[model samples]
Target: MLLAILLPFLSFMVRGKILTGIVCLILQITLIGWLPAAIWAVLSLNNARAERRNDKLIRAMKENGR
Candidate 1:
């Protein structure tokens, strides 16, 4: 919720991808392009979440000696 509001800033903090955040911020500065920026932020966030989940699953498997 709050992430969606401060996405241009939080995107870098959460994803550690400064370029992506910067691009989104630039897009957002163009009022007509703000929607695309928001959509990109959401998609990027989702990708980051999936990557984290996959990493956790791999770590659990390794810990279990799988």
Candidate 2:
């Protein structure tokens, strides 16, 4: 979260979205676009977390024959 807020473009790169990271870097290059880029990074992080959690749950359910 800190990375997302402090360096929005870097966050995207860390997540392995090179194209998106580049776009974010471009957006973050301007002061006016910084806030939106940060918000986008944070939201993307949250969604990634949720997807991971859902994947874990699905795996557990499959193991239990559910």
Candidate 3:
């Protein structure tokens, strides 16, 4: 929840997605576009999490000789 609030900054700092973060921040500055910016940031975070999970699962399966 806190991360969502700071996503515009963290997106580049933590996620290495500088362009995305910049765009989101710009959108947020427009007032009316804040919701879309938040939504985009959340979706990006979700996709990153899912990709990490899948990578971990694949590694575990390989280790188990699957």
Q: Which candidate gets the maximum lDDT versus the true structure? A: 2
Pairs that clash in candidate 2? none
Candidate 3 vs. truth: CA RMSD?
Answer: 2.0
TM-score of each: 0.73, 0.97, 0.80
Q: Write the candidate numbers in order of decreasing TM-score.
A: 2, 3, 1
User: How would you encode candidate 3's per-residue C-alpha lDDT over 1-66 as one tens digit per residue?
Assistant: 457555554664567877767777787788778777777777777888899999999999999995
lDDT of each: 0.73, 0.98, 0.73
Could you give the candidate ranking by lDDT, starting with the highest?
2, 3, 1
Per-prediction backbone clash count: 0, 0, 0
Number of the top-ranking candidate, with TM-score as the measure:
2
Model 1 Cα shift for residue 10 (angstroms): 4.3
Q: lDDT (0-100) at residue 1 of candidate 1? A: 38
**Candidate 1: misplaced stretches above 4 Å?**
5-10
Candidate 3, pairs of clashing residues: none
